[model samples]
Target chain A: GAGVSQSPRYKVAKRGQDVALRCDPISGHVSLFWYQQALGQGPEFLTYFQNEAQLDKSGLPSDRFFAERPEGSVSTLKIQRTQQEDSAVYLCASSRGATGPEQYFGPGTRLTVT
Target chain B: SQQGEEDPQALSIQEGENATMNCSYKTSINNLQWYRQNSGRGLVHLILIRSNEREKHSGRLRVTLDTSKKSSSLLITASRAADTASYFCATDGRRGSNYQLIWGAGTKLIIKP
Candidate 1:
């Protein structure tokens, strides 16, 4: 792909429903990141992956949030028992290398929990 | 918790006027970056300034970093209507830390044509 790609550009789920968002990072990129952005707010870091290794999950807000990068190229963020406050834009980004390369972002999936 | 804080939650300016935004951080940083987002979509990287560098420029974008004060500023010269977007500042802090980068709440810039 030319750039990072995310699935389900928009999703509306009822409260307590579970939802999954996917991300396809740039070809061969070694770093992947997930962020959450609420309305009228900046994106907040959710998790990070270095290749297939999930090196950082410290940013995950709670047990309801889980992210996985099985092969290091594609990742998924799953939210269980979604709440009204869970409604936000989920963003995925990738970087060329793990150290300090610039990050390229996907359009993001806007999740609306009603 | 957010590591960076940007000033001026929103700004309205006329076309062709220069727009400036500032960001401040609490901890030491390896580098700081500025990004722009339009209509709440994906963000586009504008410029990055390393701790060792005091200033950098790209096209009409100018970025400055003052490590002593843990702050940075972004200046856009001759801004246009197309430049209207939400600007945010991010920081890459100490290594071995999961929070590689912390983002600010962003400043919304509205350019009246």
Candidate 2:
């Protein structure tokens, strides 16, 4: 793809339900990032991946939040027991090499927990 | 906590007018980047200025950095209606730590045609 892409552009789940969001990064991009953006706020980093290695998972908000990039080029963010506060947009970004480079972002998946 | 603070939370200008946004950060940085977002979805990279460089330009966009003050400014000259969007500033750290790019609240720009 010419740009990074994400699936399930919008999702509405009841509280306590589990949801999964997917991301397809640009081909051969070594760095992938996940961010959580609340209404009227900037993106907050969630986690990072270097190839298949999970180098950083520090920004994840809670134990209920989990992300994986087993194949390196694709990633998934899963949220368990979604809460009302989890209603926000989940964004995915990719960079060619790592750090310092500009990150290409996906359109993001908007999750609304009811 | 966010490292940068974008001043004038919102801005409005005419199509032919210029728009200027400012950003201030707390810590030392190796580089500062500006990005634009429409409807709060994806972000498009606009410009980047290194710590040593004071200014850079791309088309009608001009960026200036003052390392001593830990601040940067973005100027969009001869703006168009399509230029209306939120602008954010991000900084790198620790060997280009991918998720470590500290971001600001952003400035919402409205270009009236």
Candidate 3:
């Protein structure tokens, strides 16, 4: 892909419902990251992966948030029992490596929980 | 918790004027990077400065990092209306292989044409 791509640009879910967001990172990238951005705020780190390994999940707000990069190419962020506070934009980024390389970001999926 | 904090929550300027934003961090970092985001869009990387480097330049952007003060400044020369966007400063602590990037709230810049 020319750039990172996210699916279902927008999602509306009722409280307690589950929603899944997908990200297709740039081809051949080795590092993937997920972030959550609240209105009028900067993106907050959620999780990070080096290829298929989930190296860091410390930033996940709760156990309800789960992310997986099965093939190290595409990833998915699933939130269970969504709450109103979950309404925000979920962003995905990928870098060439796990080092201090530049990261390319996807447009993100805007999730609205009501 | 956020490691970086950007000053001047918002700034309004006319086109062609230069805009400056500052960021302060709490701990030591391996590198500091700047990013820009338009409304309802993802962030775009602007520049990255390593801890060993005092300053760096890219096109109309100039970034200065002071590890002693744990601060960094970004100067955009000759700003245009298109430059109106939110700017963020992120820090890479280089703890391990994960490379976590702590972000600041950001400074919103509005350039009037």
Candidate 4:
């Protein structure tokens, strides 16, 4: 596609349920990132992937949040045992390079844990 | 926090007027970038100003960066109703992770048509 794309634009899950958000970045993008946005706050970094290497996962809130980009082009963010506090918009972005490059974001997946 | 802090959490302006938003950061940054988010969608990159550059322009958007004070400003000239959106300032630390860019709370801009 012309821009980054995310699947399941909106998802509602009960507490303790597991949910997965998918991100398909622009083809050939070398860098991918995952972020979580609360109601009115800015995006907070969750993790980052350079090609297929998961170089930065410090931003992930907890062990419940996991992300992977296996083939270097597509990524998935999985949340296990989702809590009410985990309800937020999951955003994915991709850049052409690993450092100091402009990131293109996707429409985001709004996960509501009821 | 190295993340930038944006002032005027909310802004309302009339069409054809100019809107300016300010952001301040704590530590040194390699570059500052501005992005626009409409409703529930994603953010679109507006402009980027490096630490060494004082100012830059793209269309009606003008961005100014002052590394000495660790501050930056984004000015939108002749605002239009379609320009209504939330604006954010993101900064990449000079010595942090390569892919991490801390973002501010953002300023919600409403352009009255």
Error of model 1, residue B60, in angstroms: 0.4
Worst-scoring 10-residue span by lDDT in model 2 chain B? B92-101
Q: RMSD, model 1, all Cα superposed? A: 1.5
TM-score of chain B of 1: 0.92
Per-model TM-score, in order, reads 0.96, 0.96, 0.97, 0.97
- Which has the greatest DockQ? 4
Off by over 4 Å in 4: none
Stretches of candidate 3 above 4 Å error? Answer: B94-98
Reference-based TM-score, model 4: 0.97
Give lDDT tens digits, candidate 2, residues B1-113. 68889987999989999999999998888889999999745899999898899999999999999999999999999999999999999987545443468789999999998
**Which pairs of residues collide in model 2?**
A99-B96
Chain A TM-score relative to the true structure, per candidate: 0.97, 0.96, 0.97, 0.97
Tens digits of per-residue lDDT for model 3 on A1-114? 399999999999999999999999999999999999998888899999999999889989999999999988899999999999999999999999866468889999999999
lDDT of 4 by residue, A1-114 (tens): 689999999999999999999999998899999999887788998888999999889888889989999889999999999999999999999999878458999999999999
Query: Of models 2 and 4, which has the larger DockQ?
Result: 4
Query: Which ranking of candidates, highest lDDT first?
Result: 3, 4, 2, 1
Backbone clashes counted, model 1: 0
Model 2 stretches with alpha carbons more than 4 Å out = B94-99
Model 4 DockQ vs. reference: 0.68
TM-score of chain B of each: 0.92, 0.93, 0.94, 0.93
Q: How big is the positional error of residue B55 in model 2, measured in Å on the Cα after superposition?
A: 0.2
Candidate 4 clashing pairs, residues 3+ apart or interchain: none
For candidate 4, lDDT tens digit of each residue in B9-91?
A: 99999999999999998888778899999976689989989888999999999999988899999999999999999999998
